[model samples]
Target: MLMRKTAALLLLSLPLALARPMSTLAQAPVQYNVAFPNAVHHEARVTATFRELPAGPLQVRMARSSPGRYALHEFAKNVYDVAATDSRGRALTITRPDPSGWAVTGHDGTVTFTYTLFGDRTDGTYAGIDARHAHLNIPATLAYAEGLEQRPAQVQFAGLPAAWTVATQLQPDAAGTTYSAPNLQYLMDSPTSLGEQQVRTWQEGGRTIELKVLHEGTPAELDAYAAQTQKIVREAAAVFGGMPAFDFGRYTFVANYLPQTSSDGMEHRNSTSLTSRRPLRGPGAIDNLGTVAHEFFHAWNVERLRPQDLEPFNFSQANISSNLWFAEGFTQYYGELVLRRAGIYPTDTEYCQEALTGLVNAMMLSPGAARFSPVQMSQQAPFVDAAAAIDPNNRTNTYLSYYYIGAANALALDLELRARFKTDLDTYMRALWQQFGSQQQNYAPARPYTTPDLQRVLGEVARDTAFAGQFFRQHIYGHQQPDYPALLAPAGLLVRPARPNKASLATRLSFNAADSTATLGTTTSGSPLYVAGLDREDVVLRFDGQRLVGSKAFEELLSTHRPGDVVQLEVRTRTGLQTVPVTLTEEPALEVVTYEAAGRPISKAQKKFRAAWLSSKVR
Candidate 1:
């Protein structure tokens, strides 16, 4: 993504004189100084000066990964021109201790380290700087000492444009340009958006809500967007019975709705970073609101009511949690459902379409669903959830995003709970909130809920431990796919294929129109493509002696042949071109749609079930 170039840069410390005594340094705040002299190069010259240092080798490091992200970012790759010095401006001996760390030795108790970080990507997880504004995710922009993570820190945005303003969850000093964090964890969780911004504020459930927007829209457009956002927040609070005791009695949404920013939404402790390619009040508005709903729900789920395994997030390594299925998946489930209850999505058809598209169909259709349980899929997050871009790996057939699977699981459980016990997921979730999220009982690294804890909660809500055990055994841990058709039957909904008995190529392909070649993507397991030894990345040059023109041409060819027909396929792999004899087959149509099953007219009982399940009221 591209960003504007302007003069303001960020420095992460309070100003301190160089001649301060070493003992007094302990009370000195760690400060950062940043300069954007080379805006054309997309780099920021950053200097971190520490008041006091421990004896021996002091390790200065950039985070390889961060909380809320399961993947390795290797933030150090963007750092260069690293140099360290003492308070007297004398160079300290520096050496590379590891790939992601720097060691400074022989310092005169006070250390100042400087480096240049190149930032281009703008999202919840990375830093993006161009002259006009700096979007900073602290982990992506700052380096911290190995043992100084517990110290208080402050930062200043030096030389910003006169009209530009900064928005973040960090506590601001007398001057808003400078901010402070109690510790490194809070610092990393806080994302800052600086530029000409539109600020909106309202109070809900006794907490002040802030929406800081940088978008191409007028006050009216932003007002409409903020109104919808307020609806989302209010509906989410209803789910938990009340609002969380937000840190500092406030919650902030750092939104960058610019055309140049990548679309993403990341949840933090008391704030979220919302980025998108769409402006408010358009066709894309609903989708953007969905992101807002999802991230806000996270304040109760992930940011506070977190899994014990992910608490005390590690900056030097990837943070993986066993409960991401609930952490992210359940939040995704709520993100959409809240919209439906908010009147933004006012139709059942709209809700079902979103459900089938986002959750149910992803689980029912993916070949990976039959191979891995949701728990296992959550474990694969470090590899699949925004891992660094480097190599090409086949994730289509082998992996399913845990968010999809987890949401599906939540759906199945919700339906089951309503069907058997007349209770719903909201009941269970509210209990979790009161126990874990209320009273400002923020999670510590040592006090996260485990899978067993989740099960216990489910059982408690259902008033039946055995049923919860069975649900976990069959769906959470087992490879058995949830019986969606059966589960939805109780809700008076039907799940069926988009096209019945449709002839198919039985192989997914990516078409390159430039070359008119069809490259193999994921092939259905046991389908003709896999059975014939065709692998991913194999280019289809010709089908049935005709040059493969495009995906449409391939589809037309498949339409011309019936199932059980044999065809000549000219495929090119790394080995060489080979004409492989393959038999065409009717692929198991997996694309599905949900509806209030037709012809079978809804009885009064069925209507009651549907109404209760869809309503916001507790049964």
Candidate 2:
């Protein structure tokens, strides 16, 4: 039997399963028996037999999207040695699938294909970071057919220890060896990693919580990460209702060491895929830890009690939405809030600063997000006509537009809700979680949500009842940027822009004829100059809301704003989508600095990223 290999790339924190780049076909249901032959050296072999084949010259196509990721990725390009055969063991013919898959056609009998998928445990398709470590993202790197995502599939494997704890969301039997999921969506969301995953289990306050880390790093460092992560997650779960709504024992963490990439994490119902550069140097390095809290929070918010768009996602097309702020952003807020409650953050100011930082960053990048209307962009992003999506600058605006903008607003709303209604912001998250996570109910199953359905949920926590739709129409789906200053002021948080340093600088910075400055490099220091004080995503209209000369003129204009002076500033936040005053401060000087933490900063795999991108040694 042969396991499959596929090709794919994750764009803008989005993970897509792509094997063949240009194919239009549906996948078919194929059962497979798979196994790992090496623990000392990780590898996977899959032998799949397709029984009950459809009659009409059928073609098998792999998905272009992964489980939680909403982008289209071709997964057939990397597959090799794909052959087909009949039930009588006779050979069948194969053909080019599309830009993304292969085709095997014959009589409606049992047919098979055997292939090897390089199983080095990394984040993306066939990601084998090293010899002993491998991550098998079968969905993105393997191909089936457009029609087969829902058929029942079973897998059996043997190569590692039977005692080694296994983590999967699929329905497991008494022996725990045989596993099954309701459909393909569950399978893709299930990323399988093999090795001695570090486990530290404990029962606190009558509930069991365990931290599992999969890695090849030093034992001491692994222990520290596991311990700290356990603390953060435990503290966070307590905030909702004393513990996770689901069992944490089966929860797995796949932390990949891939620097110069997404370096982010994807949250699932029971697990998460975190790609990062380990052994980080300082506070910046702790971003990954914070990411863990963010995704962990999603286990309840987005994964369990999800919105209409996500309940039954249309794998064939984009599930358009405007409420990503609630699902993603509010969780971002809770990540830090939980940490702060656990004393990990150590200071309320810092907690507020972290959330405020996200808010301010969005303001500075305004009008940038305005291009993609919530109704249009959310519906079209995964299937975006790439040719038409690229902006005039050859830069895709999506990197900062949708997710980031929505997340920043989410934090503000949670805080504002607490400040406004004087109650724990939204019970919608908890309510939804109770229905889906606890009672296992479905609000939206592969169906579009009506405007009233969304409003009904918001009314649970909304102080201003009639304004929910207006809020969505204006700040969310409209062209205006989110207003952060006012949102923060009500809660005693201030989002003041920082001025560049007196002597510190890295990337080459330049000003256009209009005073707008451009930070040129893979990572910029200031991030497009707040797009005219609009706040993280405020679209620059003029020097102070006026139509600029052009891109170059915009940069030149930024060169003229002085420190402490009330330069004209404006933005769009959730409170009312109105322009407000923001006092600009001198860009505080920042230098390469490191401080020792009680624990390890990153894993060995993640260290590789910092060596390539930062100024200090990771160790």
Query: Who wins the lDDT comparison?
Result: 1
Model 1 — TM-score against the truth? 0.92
| TM-score list, all predictions | 0.92, 0.68
lDDT string for model 2 (1-619, tens) is 1132221211011112333222212333456655445323434455666666666555666565565556654555445556777877777877774665567777455667755555443553334423333456757444555555555554443444433444445445567555554345666666655445666666644555445555445677766666667777766565555455343245656665434233657777667777666543345446767888888887777676566666665544435555565566567666766666555566545654565565556545533454654444444445442322443341234434445556665554555555456544435455444444554422122233443565565665574666666666675666455566655444434454344522112123332345442223232324333322232233323336654545555545555665544445333333434444534445442211111121325444334322221111111
lDDT of 1 by residue, 204-263 (tens): 989999999998889999999899898889889888888887767889999998877889
Q: Tally clashing residue pairs in candidate 1.
A: 11
lDDT of 2 at 187: 65
Q: For candidate 2, which ten residues in a row score worst on lDDT?
A: 6-15
* Candidate No. with top TM-score: 1
